[model samples]
Target chain A: MSLVLRETALAFRRAPLLSALSVTTIAFSLFVFGLFGLVAVNIQRAIGNVAERVEVVAYLKRGTPLQAVALAAADIEAFPEVESVQHVTEQEALARARRDLREFQDIFQDLETNPLPASLDVRLRPAFRDVQRAAAVAERLAALAIVDDVRYGREWVEKLDRLRNIAGAVGTVVGAAFALVAIIIIGTTIRMAVLHRSREIAIMRLVGATDGFIRRPFLLEGILKGLLGGVLAVGLSYGGYALIDAYLLRASFFTAAQATLGVAAGGFIGLVGSLVSVGRHLRST
Target chain B: MIKFTGVTKEYLKTGAALKQVSFHIARGQFAFLTGHSGAGKTTALRLIYLAERPTAGEVRVSGFSTARAGPREIPRLRRRLGIVFQDFQLLEDRTAEENVAFALEVTGARHTTIRPRVMRVLTQVGLAGKANQYPRELSGGEQQRVAIARARVNDPVVLLADEPTGNLDERATRGIFQLLKDINASGTAVLMATHDLDLVRSMDAHLIELQQGEVVYDSAEDAAGRQPVAP
Candidate 1:
């Protein structure tokens, strides 16, 4: 262990510029990855919120009895996909219209009788938030005897769902690509370090040093670089998140668990990279 | 002790580097391997340290058959032997003391044991006061001494030197030869490979001469008035 430490210290001392460059490259790569993660998390959260608000509005027929309207609502609520049903009376619908369009309030006041039909607002469970599923539920509601028509923003919901899928796919692909690049960068850096100390390694081998003994110091160096890079990335991400949160009055995009996971991933990448580079060199020698 | 029996080394690119060469050095014995360039002198030493396996036959160093030693066993076998190079392959950035200590360090020696042993070897090589000097700062002879110190630091049962004086002046060569002789006096068997006939004749040590991967002459056998067939 002391030998590993000494060798690592000597390596850094021998090539400070190279070590710094490696660490910087790793930090920048991890920072970009973390930034993408933050964006993906925020986008997913926004999509979830939008999907939760999707509901089917079922209008009641004119002169429908109050008891019939309540029965229709109860039947809609019994659907497996339905989460809840809210009854909107004609008077309440008129009042909502008045609140939504105050400038058109004069037109509603001039009406002799309430022409607005009562409606049943049907909210589906989160699993049934797809455009096709909601449309199917709306069709079932529209068949009710007391229901006149059923409407849900199928086109808009489909578009939003597509957008969410695209975001998720792009996030995964780009994140994986970034991680692969980070591993390559780290492996190349460690390879350079090993090359720089090739003579030392040969001498060690001559003196009965096992492959593990010769490789430990370099592995430690790679891990240390990875750990520092992770810390830098985490710090930058946290600071950026704090800045965004402060300016936009929004909650953090990355959870504590995600931050920890990111750091762990960085360390793991460094270890794998080191192992690959060192193993190749050892095999060749 | 080191022994090679009908050892042959074949390289795909260059063919045989050593061919059916056989010899033996008893415990605490000192011998010289002398030959022209590409005469298998270095290859013979390499086989002793398990650097090259015999394409045929066997090599035994300190009672371990190098040809049969597994990967995990090779390092342990090497720990019982020390090797010196023609270029005096010292770590240029490290102090002489550190270079010597590195040998022990690789063997997982304790810190307290390593320090005194490193100092003792440096002193043995007459570099006690220059322990802290880097290879670049030291003279050619001092650097060579550092290499020797590193090799001797572990008190290996056998010391293999390949052209140890190839880059040294007459003064440095004599000093290094004397050091090797003194090291041998301390009971470590030494196998030194060189083409310096004058030094070999001067010392009159046991000589094994190779020619085109074949052993042409062995002094010990010659002293017994026996001639072995050369392949």
Candidate 2:
């Protein structure tokens, strides 16, 4: 081992209790930040997953031609905001209506000629699915020739806009708070290290060691603590997400397909955020 | 060689610690700096080591100006000379060999070269058997031996000792002096600052006495006119 690393390792080993104290303290602070990082990621992804349901539905005119219905769906898909288009034929619509009416036996006397018009369900790309953007898309679809009505959930879309805004605001505030807390904890930990090893530093200085060489090991220790803490926090948050997912599936609501889709995105965010925080701590003091 | 020209040191809180002091020690010369307590003995030693910048006047050690030496030059200047503290200043956590090797390690010696050099020096200081012993395991004089080993490890051109025998008994003091004499006999300049005036008188070595930061006597120059003292 090089002398600087060897000396740092020796010093740390000599006082394992103090070194462990620094590591765990740094880990706990980073853990809090990492957990929040995961929460924010999952929240956005969940909202996004549910928000996919908010699509512009182009209801066709009564007695509209088969060719016209297909043409309308195709035209809607051509819009930059539209992701995919599905054509619900008149017969299919009638069957679905009949199934609904069968639940209330008194309402459906008979399944006669299908009166439900064929409609186009147009799912939107994530960026254009916001309430304001979705409304613009709906208006543009209504302007189409064969569209009898351009319908998307005005109230539902508006509610989601509000909810998404609230989530974003909460994420920002919590992120900043946890960031401050983490920096303070790490700073205090480093300052404690400096104070404890002041004598060692003074002697090293006396022996011609530059300031940079002296500070390197402490910085490495800080980074290690942060990375380990990030792993732990990710584990805790994943466990929490898993438990929630399990409960949802047990109650016959959302399934495993729902959570796994967002897991990769969430994990990426957590790892990056933890690394950035640790880097900031290392450079700051 | 060290040359202090009109050098004066001041402590702001106490003020005027050392008056304008002037002297020179040539290459491979052994001299003793004798003074009373608070007579600027440590201050004089500090000037040569660049431990403290003089409050006024210029001081040069081994041709590097103390007042103007940059960061890069300071280490190079210090590498040429060695200074031992009065308190030994041995790390309590390190073995005697480790303490001696610290000097070489700081100057960027290769790890392969350091072990052998540390061993050779420790053996020279009579601490070869005690290389593995920690500072607390050794007595005051033995610990001082470890420190002397550290000072001379890199084969410094000049060795400065500040109150090195303060904690030793008469026998240990004699042993330490004999070691210093042996090192000097090999042509490495040795300057020991001490309070033992009787030891100074009996040794018949060159002596320079400082009283209140001014030279009071010079044995080498005064003895030049008198009959030469026995070797």
Candidate 3:
């Protein structure tokens, strides 16, 4: 193992320029992938923020007692998908309309009796905030004795679902494409490194070195380069994130685990690239 | 010991390199393979080292036969023998000592033993003082000596030299030839391929001459017909 390390060091020392070039190339490739990942994460967060507003409002009958509505709220909150249920009095509903819909102030001010009905505002959990789940919960709420009608903006919820699905699908496909490009570029850079040392490899084989022995140093070099490149890529991605956050809209950087995964992906790509390049060199010569 | 029986090597592009060539070298013998540029001398040496297999017949070296040796066994067989080329195939980036140590290192020799063994062979080739010098810093003759030191570091049973002195001047050629002679005197058989007829005539060594890929003359087989010989 020490010998392997020594050989790896020797290779780097022998061609520092080429080694640096390889690492830089790998870093940039992974950087592109990292940029896409950042975009995907931010898009997903935006969709999630929008989904949080998804709630079903069940309007109560005018003659329903407040005591009965409180009991219904308790039962509705017990549902697995229900995050929370709030009972809004008819007066509170009128006040909300006055605060939220300022453009309809003239009509609301002229009203003698409160036209709004008391309602149960049912907010679903984030996981159950899709069109289908919201509709299912609305159906259940409307079946209650006191619930005269239910309104959760069916078309709006469906549009949000469509937007979420498109974002997820596009994220996956683009992410995969970027990752594949990064791998191919990294593999090519490592191949150039292997070819740079072709003479040394030929000498090793001539001196009776086994294929495993010949591959060890190159493998180590590849992994090390990959790891370094990965860290560099993460750094580059962070720089990009900072620039975007400062100049454009505020954006979320990768979580700690995601950043670590990015580094590991770099190392993994390096290993695979070195394996292929060295394997080809060994087989051909 | 090295022996070839009816060895024929055919390439797809160039056709046959060696055509039914046969020769034998006993243990501890110093032999010269003399031929013109395209006379299959390198191919014959390559066969002895297992770099290329003979299309027909067999190459038996130190109990390993080309017909029977598996892929896994090739490195093991190579470890028992030393191979030298005219270009002095040393890693240019490494020092002479490092180049010599590479051979021992490949065989997984003890790390502690490598330095001493490398020094011994470098001293044997009279490059003990220049062990730290890289190949580019050394002359043609000195670089070849480094290569010889690397070859001899393994204490191989046989040394196969494919035009070891082809790139050297007359003085360096004499020096390398004397070095090989000294190595041969220490009981390691040397089979050298060279087109230098003058070098072939310089000493009383076994000679094999190839012409158009056929062995026209072999000192050991003046009377024996082209038949397989059991070692």
TM-score of chain A of each: 0.82, 0.79, 0.95
Q: What TM-score do all the candidates reach, one by one?
A: 0.88, 0.82, 0.95
For candidate 1, give the lDDT of residue A137: 98
- Scored against the true structure, residue B135 in model 1 reaches a CA lDDT of 94
In order, candidate lDDTs are 0.87, 0.75, 0.92
Candidate 1 per-residue lDDT over residues B1-231, each given as its tens digit? 688989999999999999998998888888999999999998898888887788999998887996668977878987888788889999888899999998898899988899999999999999999998889999898899999999998889988999999999999999999999999999998899999998899986778899999988897686554763321
Indicate the residue-level lDDT of B23 in model 1. 92
Q: Give the CA lDDT, 0 to 100, for residue B164 in model 1.
A: 95
Positional deviation of residue A162's Cα in model 1 after best superposition, in angstroms: 2.0
Question: For candidate 2, lDDT tens digit of each residue in A1-285?
Answer: 366578767767877787677656665665566556666766787898889898888888887888888777777788889899998888887767767767755444464666577888889998888888888988888887788998898999999999999999999998999877767666666566666766665555556554455555555554554454445545555665577668753212223453342333233333344344434533442
Better of 1 and 3 by TM-score: 3
Off-target runs (Cα >4 Å) in candidate 3 are: B223-231
Give the CAPRI rating of model 2: acceptable
What ranges in model 2 sit over 4 Å off? A97-116, A225-285, B204-231
Clashing pairs in 3: none
- Tens-digit per-residue lDDT, A1-285, candidate 1: 766788888888888998888888788889888888887888888888999999999998888999988887788888999999999999999999988999999999898999899899899999899888998999898888888998998898899889988998898898899878878877787788778888878778888899998878888888888888888898888887888889975855677888888877877877877888888987887
- How much of the real interface does each model capture, measured as fnat? 0.77, 0.17, 0.80
